[model samples]
Target chain A: MRIPLSITDNIQEWLVSMMSESAASYVAMIIVALIYLGIFAIAGLFLVLIERRVAAWFQLRIGPNRVGFQGLLQTMADALKLVSKELTGTDRADKFLYNLAPYFVIISALMALGVMPFTKEFQAFDINIGIFFLIAISSIGVIGILLGGWASNNKFALIGAMRSGVQTISYELSVGLSLLTMILLTGSLQLSEIVEVQKGGWLIVQGHIPAIIAFMIYMIAGTAETNRAPFDMVEAESELGAGFHTEYSGMKFAYFFLAEFINMFLIAAIAATVFFGAWLSPFGITESIPWLGVFWFLAKTLVLVFLMMWFRWTFPRLRVDQLLTLEWKYLLPINLVNIVIMAFIVWQKLIIQI
Target chain B: MGYFSNIFNGIKTLLTGMSITGKYFLNSRKGAITQQYPDNRETLKMFDRFRGEVIMPHDENNEHACTGCQKCEIACPNGTIEIIWDRGIDEETGKKKKKIDQFVYHLSMCTMCGLCIDVCPTDAIEWGQNFENSVYDRTALTRVLNEPESKVRAGIED
Candidate 1:
């Protein structure tokens, strides 16, 4: 299933019941790490395949189809090829961070799953300020990307990494402001509690127009934060070869690639949680049926992922100046205003009568 | 004042931009551009002119019209073709002749130059639609002729 933390919870529960309660926490952490690696491998394969198909449709062209059924196994074949390929290091490249960056990026993204709520009952830590924790961890991923770019000793790599670092930091403000509105509405920052509140009716419906506006802002800022197109100045193929990780090879390169897709899913899942109401859909309508909420949660996330793919394929990459303008001049100010209005609404009850 | 105007303009722009995505999202039906390729390959039509693999044409008696002319090989810059020849004696005329043992065209190496067919004086070859030539073995690209030796002899006799 697409659920990340539920499996971790299941492991924790089994360990607690079978073994001592204290040791159960240790078992749970280990299980979460295994799941982190397992999910990253599987999801990266699926993301690559989906991206090719989505690009194909947008451009009215056929994508890879000969390797497996509709090229479903194409990424696995690519992974195999990558494993066998020899890694070439630049003669002048820094040996340490060049090797360390990919693992750092992957681990930082994996840390995000620790706070992400997959279902009502499943969360690793379920910190009261889970949304803030998620943002903080995702931001660390940019550091790894930046290190990889700088360590590569290539001009393009350095440029890509620096661009990525700046873009991520700037867009984070807008993303944070958008989520702050939801925090104001729910009044509690715990992810499970937020999902529980949405059980009666989703935040999208209950919070109404403001929630949707926040969602739109979140999407724009989130896309930019992840270094996804059209804000993908770091990986601009025309100007830069492979961007920040250009000098990386073998599983190290694969790790960086995995981190990107996982980060994409993280943003999509968190967006679904905060703004689209986590795993809730119209109470009794979905609650009566077992596993319906999980299905709806996944369906929502996949739709968001498809929208991301459409965006990457259809739009041209933005200039660095224009990209920052979009954030500072447009998204940041709008979100700032949105937060103020939302806070005002909560305090004064300015929401229109039904 | 300028800052507020900027913020206000942003909200308008964001809404206008979101409305476009939301409108399409709300209006979209099934067939969300997900094409199941193999299932749909029956309806797949490439224009008659796509330069894929080259094929040698065989007559009703299975005689290929190629006379082992090296013009196509000379014209090609990539050296994708290597026309192998086998010397043989005609049974009916007691005359020695040079025949193609293999008109080996490496599909991977081919740049789809179509010069091979154009240079063939006998109209013996043309581009074919069978593009499913990808394989694990690189050597599988050398296509053996469908034309029988008897038919080739008949053509020589004619």
Candidate 2:
């Protein structure tokens, strides 16, 4: 018997076959949500492990290797430790908002993960406004940081949160504009449709010069948006003493930590999907085997993730003023000009076709 | 003109920084400077002159080099070494010789300065390389350098 390639489709069919239509849909939604949650947790943990290992390597040291074979279970152990820790709060903190903050950050990141096309048909929610949804959802994560910082009733936390608000707002422009440049090439807002357009050739290859610039700008902005190092004004440990989540302890702290890694993965995944061909095998070598698309997608995403990790380890954190200068002075201007270039290229039918 | 040049130079410097780290990352297997202690105990070797602790070397005959000399005790800055000695007749020489009843070493007070080893007139004491000195009880840090019932080596001039 030939194995079905689309596991999601097969699962959907099985669910429908076994239950009433409405019930099947409900069951499918529940199952998909559960699966995405599992993925979010596992991916966050795995990315943290990867970041630690990569950071260690760059610093000429061995990272965690004693927990489980090459420290595979280190993050798992950390998660357990975090869960068992006492949830502490400041004496005079805003109780309601402080308690409510981490969920906002974590839920926003989890929602963004729903639309990622891991393979041809593996996406949980393949909404038509996929890119827009991601952009909108990702921006909501800033609210969590702001709330966490404000409700903590600490000066440093407030400063960090305010810096984050400023940084995210500024970089958000470059991120949208750069992705907007690519959108001009694909002429579609749908992520899968964007990937389908790349079947002729990857967007980066087709729209070579401008697309490369957009990719670079997108990477910079995306890294900033995630509040990662070099752009981690949100949690500038030296300046803000753990920043927005300073008052958070135990599982609440873990939620913020996990969400950061998830956001990094989201940024890299978006870069992988939009710039590189999402789940499309390079040169159609693995085209016959549709299942291999998942492998390719993950491999591409991991490469971008490693790039982000590289940036984190190599670059020092930007000063608050310098951060804004970079966004407004360099990235914004370049992104604006690149979008126009991309538009001109599209108008002249100058895109490279395979 | 300079505006664009500044951007280019900035990116170039950033790339240079990345290349340096990237080089180390690629060569990390051979370049990692961390030594996994305990796990690598069998292979780990301290330097020859590392002042881990003061020790008295004894032979197969249970004879040591120390002759109850107070030089180490006197040389120790913090009085980490203490010698309780008794005058005993040497059978071969038929003379009174100072022999240690207990050669106590307070490792807690010892700074590992090698002063005690340097000042031992009979070349009795030397540095030991066993540095895992932690103990639950404070009294456990006080060590007896000479083995119980051990005698001084024969044919050594005081």
Candidate 3:
């Protein structure tokens, strides 16, 4: 697949020609890293505020609209408070692992963010194995949850972490399978390539029933993978007090909190890219203006993000057994059948190609 | 068929739940119950019958209806009301009359039960709906109902 030339690509070429190729590449990596960090912080703040406001609306209350201009800076203020808080650990806790776990979770989420195609040319690493890399890195978040729980020396934390481990492992299959269903349609694993294929229409509209089923399955599994509510047995405040990060305080706790929202974003972004057209304007309305691709991508991602938030507010947390049953009994089987069906559709050339 | 129907039912119920929340989310413009507190203070009036605090109303001449009646003080379960009274000469009649020196209301201690207001014979005390009564000091919460240099209404002398 030929890489589409964008402003950033032009800058990269100029830098490589002017400087040592290796040094220029290193600088480019650093630049992308810094951009992603800024994005993570802003998106984390925005998503948390949106979640709180949406939850409030659903429950007939006004959420945090006091800090700055309808509570825009509420998360920023919360981050400050968390940073200033005293870092406390239990007496029997393994201090090293307890401190290290949050970074593991945060880094995994950050790695996933790196590969996402924000616009036609605006991607950090545009890897050929984008979906594969995303799936692989996202699974690593469970290790942090496990380590935090085990190191806490608390029974509730252990239970929460174990539930999280079980939940993530079970749902990951459905996430992969659903993506595979779409990958069959696109015949490419590259994020940009997958997106380029959607110029005909979105995979959802192109493949119809199978693609829609894949989307539904992906959403359920992705919500569980993110450890969000209805599937949030991991942090079930009513059952296990604060879950895996029970003993963590200060910025370490903030990392775990922020990472959840960031992961929620990655899930939505992926959904927008693979199933919906990544940065493709609906009916190519704004195709002439390349910069508008970023707008189209964000508008699509926000819609999916809103859907996830709605799920969090509307649905009750499933029990540990119920959570497993939901994935194993319902989602997993449906996903398997859906994939076979999608393959058949692709082979028969039933797709509504433009 | 049963297996597929069960899956369909599950999806249907989940969609049903989503629709309900979707209705609230869309209807939020009219359905939002939030009373934006400080911002709405200008128009935010409490109900007429709302019991917030016990207050004694005074007219333009600074004359109150309370004639040192000890009934309110006795009716108060929390010992919240303290009426300090002394015998004084009534200027018009040249006769000794019981007069109130201080009507001390310990607002912090008062339960806002309205019993004192109910027991008042002169109907001097009524529920005040000014609920924003937070104070910095405990002593600051102890309020004097009667204005300085004010006397009881002449008609209420019994």
Candidate 4:
């Protein structure tokens, strides 16, 4: 059968071959899934290194220069150390739940990879509900934190978990509301659809004043949701004694650490997809280049991730009350009202006319 | 009326806050405030009052003026110093000399507490202001600063 030819024609043919007389498509999909997981781990390692470097710059000191070649392999060494060390379980705690929490966090973060369309041909699943699916899966990492905290039977851990729950739930509303503004403008739930709309230009550049404002709102709320600094009160070292993971030791603690970094990348990647254009370049020029979309997308996300790490190192963690106030008093009302106005403007076709 | 004005004032305040950041961001012609250290250590000089490595005062013949009083040793809480003593043979008076012997100062164990200097009676010790003391071996850090016999004799006669 003759297929309608396009730029992804070669990719389509390869996928079709996998479906005929073999379990090749299933095997290929698993390989692609593992590739995405590898990307997550690699990104997490780089993010951890970047965070330390930025922190060193902020505090006017050199950081982690002793590890492999200006600390390039610091994360590798750290992971090896964590793996070799003991993973202790609390005697008083529910052993099943305690053992289960880190897995929950790691699995959910890995699940977020399924919805992310790395390129048109590079996605694991071409699901229609990709954006919301990402949001849903990534949020489960928070439940892991709460579970780990509660199961440990440590007072500080419980308090930290409580803080994380409140913070996560609060910031989630602002993020949702900010992103809702974009969904209203673009009129799609799927991330691929959103990227399609931004074929001409990234949303940050294409959409006028209101869209830019929404982008800023999303960035701030996403940073908080990632539990990075300025919003890192959940694990405020001074206040809560390592917060929710206080009772955790060795490998279980390592899982929690890895989860935090992966979530940071996930949020950044989602932000790249939503506001900056997933894998599209300016003026729909990427259609000619074939791979420019994915390149531009990864580059943009890495830049955003670096900026988030910079913010983490530059500022002291905000007080819990101050954090709540920023969300409730400022971000919430602005995003809520902004979406309503954007909806009206989009419906009337005022965006193009004006 | 005043409360409504406060909202406008709030907007103005935010703009003002943004403008300060704006000015700094735009002023790229100005040199960056960051300094890459260790690379630029050749021209580095500590401030006048910066406390760094400790030095013992030496006589013209290269000898320290410390006696075996062990006051500084007593003042050091971390036991970073070990003052070994030996009876001095007197050629004229035929009596033991109350002079310092082996003055061992361990840099590894040093907390940079200046209490030893504070307790010194001879005004022989002061901060060296030389802090590039990273050595290859731990044993190299354990300094044994004893006066040579010739210099000790010259100090006693003087």
Q: Tens digits of per-residue lDDT for model 2 on B1-158?
A: 69899999998999999999999999999989888997999998887977788888998999998877688888888989889899999898899878889999999999988877777777888888887889999999999988999998986653
Runs in model 3 with CA error above 4 Å? A1-8, B47-128, B135-158
C-alpha positional error of residue A75 in candidate 1 after TM-score superposition, expressed in Å: 1.3
Q: After superposition, how far is residue B71 of candidate 4 from its true place, in Å?
A: 11
Interface CA RMSD of each prediction in angstroms: 5.8, 0.5, 1.0, 6.4
Q: For model 3, give the interface RMSD.
A: 1.0
List where candidate 1 sits over 4 angstroms from the true fold.
A1-20, A350-354, B1-158
Tens digits of per-residue lDDT, candidate 3, B20-128, equal: 9999988886888888888899999887998788888999999999989699999999899999999999898899989999999999998988899988889988999
**Per-prediction TM-score, please?**
0.71, 0.83, 0.82, 0.75
Count of clashing pairs, candidate 4: 0
RMSD (CA, angstroms), candidate 2: 5.0
Residues A1-354, candidate 1: write the lDDT tens digits.
123345566676787799886678777778777865787678778988888866765555566777889899999999998888888778778888788888889898888887766656545667777888888898999889989998898999999998998898898898888989888888888888888777656777767778888988898888887788888898998989889988889888888887888888888999888877666664456776646667777777888988777667656788999998888887777788788878888788654322
* C-alpha DockQ of every model: 0.06, 0.64, 0.53, 0.12
Better of 1 and 4 by TM-score: 4
TM-score of chain A of 4: 0.90
Model 2 lDDT, residue A321, Cα? 88
- The fnat of each candidate, in order, is 0.00, 0.79, 0.65, 0.00
Best by TM-score: 2
Alpha-carbon error at A318 in model 2, in Å? 1.4
**Of 1 and 2, the candidate ranking higher by TM-score:** 2
Q: Higher DockQ: candidate 3 or 4? A: 3
Clashing pairs in 3: none
Report the Cα RMSD per candidate.
8.5, 5.0, 4.8, 6.4
